[model samples]
Target chain A: MIGTAQKIAIEKTKTSKITSVDFDNLPFGSVFSDHMLVCDYRNGAWEAPKIMPYQPISLDPSAKIFHYGQSVFEGMKAYRDKDHNIWLFRPEDNYKRLNVSSKRMAMPELPKEYFMEGLKTLLQLDRDWIPQSEGSSLYVRPFIFASGRGFHASPADEYKFIIATAPSGAYFSSGKVKVLIEETYSRAANGGVGFAKAGGNYAGQFYPTQLAVEKGYQQVIWTDDNAHEYIEEAGAMNIFVRIKDTLVTGPVSDRILDGITRKSILEIAREEGIPAEVRKLKVNEVVEAAKNGTLKEMFGAGTAAVVSPIAAFGYRGSDYDLPQLEKSYASRFKKRITDIQYNRSEDSFGWRFKV
Target chain B: MIGTAQKIAIEKTKTSKITSVDFDNLPFGSVFSDHMLVCDYRNGAWEAPKIMPYQPISLDPSAKIFHYGQSVFEGMKAYRDKDHNIWLFRPEDNYKRLNVSSKRMAMPELPKEYFMEGLKTLLQLDRDWIPQSEGSSLYVRPFIFASGRGFHASPADEYKFIIATAPSGAYFSSGKVKVLIEETYSRAANGGVGFAKAGGNYAGQFYPTQLAVEKGYQQVIWTDDNAHEYIEEAGAMNIFVRIKDTLVTGPVSDRILDGITRKSILEIAREEGIPAEVRKLKVNEVVEAAKNGTLKEMFGAGTAAVVSPIAAFGYRGSDYDLPQLEKSYASRFKKRITDIQYNRSEDSFGWRFKV
Candidate 1:
């Protein structure tokens, strides 16, 4: 059990213990690490944050966060090297992206120093949890919520910023995944909070994703809400498609998340002398390309699953099975990206952050 | 500080010894009452809820609620009658509205017992904060959050249900407020989380609301995202327009919140035999109605202020002032609503819930 210490005060607790989280095989979000970092905003200033043992918090049911959904979040990972030194892959991007999310959600912008220092301080203490096995890392989640009384439709006077870590393996146990192109539901809309990593945006997709799972698909690839023509993203990850020799993906807009891995993969593709293009990839064009055997490969890119190759696509109850190729682009992209992440190759893009 | 001992064991804390919050000088959510109610969604079942003294909670900052906005909340108030008895007006409506919000946002649906039992328990302990002052009541905020670990784009396995109270004064101290009609910015989209009380939906409006405030308006009335032509809700409140004595409000959709106060106002309008139309209210049509002297009164309705009459509107740098009338329709509606709320008048529609 963690000590009952307040993060803002830096006041030490009578007892500080190394708590243990039951790390038996888990099904995501079930287990947690020992210590968590928290910072509170009140009186027009952000207080000093602290790391204490993980425990349940007491909140007035009336706090603005739970009801009004004034919350935003970021996703990044801490990789464990062969030498037992902890490394973070592209953490600055996560910090910058978090602020971008904060701006879109109208939450206060958390300083990059605060994000870096908080995660560093917190992860340094929980470094044992970063698995060294391939496709394993310490997933770090940083989020902020409005914490105040009553339910007026305005900003909360108080905010709580907390960080938690989870030991996670690769997103998929299988080599490839199947996606269902969503026709009815959308992850986000134009001029909406789609690009932001706000909690509500994720919650909005659960039912549709569940429907996809029920229909024997791994995830649903969302499209633009206004027209449902332009491909947006797949579940939480950004997607890439290879038509003939050229790679095509959707452009980043208010409706699409600007994925860090998506950006990295694009950079890698160019460095490898592969044709990578970011533009409006219409659904019909991709479907036609797949039918004509021009679409050689399709995959999702995100921090969790560096490159998840899509083996098939289900649309309007019609299944389109992708042909297996001796040399696939997804395998190449995944290997190149993961190598840089684990520091197995030269760090040309300066993506690795050593802890 | 409230004892963490009572927080864990479901034992009621002794709040009688705690210093009470001054109800008279309450500045919105700054002050809280002595007790709070909470329930947990664990082991796939909601446990029996409890009410204890209000206190701080410990949580991993990376919990899904903070980052992804996997949070939903509702705002309602417990009214004090002239006879010193406490009453709740159609809390079932708020519960239903909260569920609607939950389904849309992909959070777990709170049980009716957690919604009702939690509120009753908290209000019973903190009834002292239910101000007897006119237009004042103990504001109740019931919310649910994603308490699970990690930042993956999936539904949370664990959740918390809480109810907190704050004593608030009248929504507006002086006369009717002026609002700016936002032609560009949007609150929610057809496939967005706007209809739900999701936090990100409100966060997305903060910047636009600030712009409206800078334009010398209290709130920015939203329009549809695609065309910015159809009128939606106000900043944190559902809006109403009176056209030639007919109370008009927008039809609730993916773009608008299903407010408890909005539903009640509709009931009151019907009971009084006043013509009330619920449909798509276009901004241009509203402007024409105001120019033709048919727009009688514009008001914003929610649990906090109940109903605030809007005196004028600013659109594209043009100002339109609603005529001032004696025994204004807004005053009549607010009085009738408050009368039934405070038990001063008969609740002909059986809207009042005795606690």
Candidate 2:
């Protein structure tokens, strides 16, 4: 086993591109930092982690990633406090979830030390890229793919682990998004790889989400595959529905992602004396709640958005508008989570990790 | 629209690597031919196709294919007859199916001219690499992936269409394969991408298939996700079960792949006066058939193997061995298909395409 204290090889770029970037006009994930971390797994062992200049990678045409999609990834963010101290929101959870995804995809599990040390070193080198403005941070993407040269429909023998960070603005810039409740298209199935942040899971959602977009919705609320009656996820995030005074979200199963932001929100809600239920939420229940004027709020929670509010929803050829509230649960949860992430709140839960 | 007579730029290798390759001991998909075909889709149009030396491709770390799994592929083969004439079986079907998969994955479809002209030119350039042995031929892989740069969960703006060929031995070398009937895992879900040749569809099966391998089975017969009672597919191929006299196979739906070799087998069975039925096959019916000694044969059909006979199958902690037959449908169909493919028999269905 590789030790956590293993040294990481660093190669600094001769010149940085920090001066040419427009921090205020940055897109979600377009602007990458100067340095990245790369590690190769070959001959049944991961090589030493290397932090080098961010550039294109060369891979054979027959690489398993392109042919079989044996790839997994994790999304995270590094926040900059007023005192210039960098913080990460529950990064260990992301690490564990990445391995869970890797195991499900039949890829090799990455060591904790390689992920942590490499990410920290790369972040420290590109500290200037982290946006200090409100709702802006460095979106970190750590991914692993099958770099082996073969076309067989089997697990790959070689892999590549990479960490790339991008400075980004808010995922949903200004308004709450409108989502279509998808009944015809499904995101994941039971006993499948839906819980894992596998590449195929995201790719499979593009077509259905595009149909929703064409119908004037910004995203889709994916339901269960077997029945398409129970709510599962909202686009790439875990969905929470506020009915009456209780917050209800689907329980994490083999078909739903175990989102970190989602769990944190639940913990914060309970701490604040709010009722949060993790159970199977049916779409009909939400539709009835909307019809009876009991649906107060609905939102999506993930690392990218922290919390994205849903302004309206369309279900079964009928549009339902949500009533705006002065003190909505969506805003409260977003504030509570971002406060912990940016070091503005108490450290009672020990959720913040200083780098 | 690109016409069928579009020009394809050709760049030949300065030297050949054929002399170094040991053709007798060839692996499945490890070795590649000297030339390959590459075409790019950008700005809402596919560019002209190009035939170049088989080599590695460079892409940014944030390429959508690495993170989103927006990739699809098709498998084919090139056969060399005794007179050195090259032939392809049902090439148009492969091309049409590639686009069908591309549409389902939200990828840009390749022009017919690009796929046909590019493949033909590459095969002509690497004709010497096609092994002429009894079970040896050039395996062709036509794949497309999202090459655009982004990390968002949406369809990419650019894509790459590539064709790579490898000379190899038979997929199933000599003996029949043992399979496990999966009751806990699934290959696809209803209203999912199971019908398409999407990359994620294959990757999701690796872990479950690995479990079957650990239990002494070579592959798995994946059942439906909802009930795990209906037989869907066997490993990466479409499965067929023979009970007494009638050959029964599952029909293609949103949760099952439309295999090329599978449909051809059905057609050949009908033409040969063999009873064939395409419908939903129940696992319990097969178990009953096995118990009564009426289960005669089971086989997997796909482009890679053409036909692979199953020797035994295990279900719910019970192993069942099939009776050895003097003349099995697996052998008969494989011979008939190979005869049509190699131009040794009459092309009644006009399935052979000469390059």
Winning candidate number (DockQ): 2
DockQ versus reference, model 1: 0.49
Model 2: per-residue Cα lDDT over A1-355, one tens digit each: 4454347888999989999999988789988899999999999999998989999999999999999999999999999999999999899999999999999999999999988888888888899999999989999999999999987788999999999999998887667799999988888877999999999999999998888889999989989888898999975789999999999999998889999999998998989999989999999999999999999999999998789989999998999999989999999999888898999999788999987
Candidate 1 lDDT over residue span A1-355, tens digit each:
1222323333333444324543444334445677778888888777778777776665655566766677777778888788887888888888888888877666788866678877877777778777777777778878887886555667777888888777877667677699999877777766777788776677778878888899999898998777778778985799999999898999998878899999988898888899888899999998998889888888899887778889999877788888787888888988887887787888888888887
Cα misplacement distance, residue A303 of candidate 1 (Å): 0.5
Q: Candidate 2: what's its TM-score on chain B?
A: 0.98
Enumerate the candidates' DockQ scores in order: 0.49, 0.86
Candidate 1 lDDT by residue in tens digits, B1-355: 1222233334556645335556566665556677777777777777667776677755655566766677777778888887778899889989998888778766778777667766765776667778888767777777778887555678777888777777877666565689999876677767666777776677678777877888888888988888888888985679999888788899998778888788888887787898999999999889999889898888898777688888899998999999887967678878888898899999888989998
Model 2 ranges off by over 4 Å: A1-6, B1-6
**Which residue pairs collide, candidate 2?**
none
Model 1 misses residue A164 by how many Å? 3.3
Cα RMSD for candidates in order: 4.8, 1.1
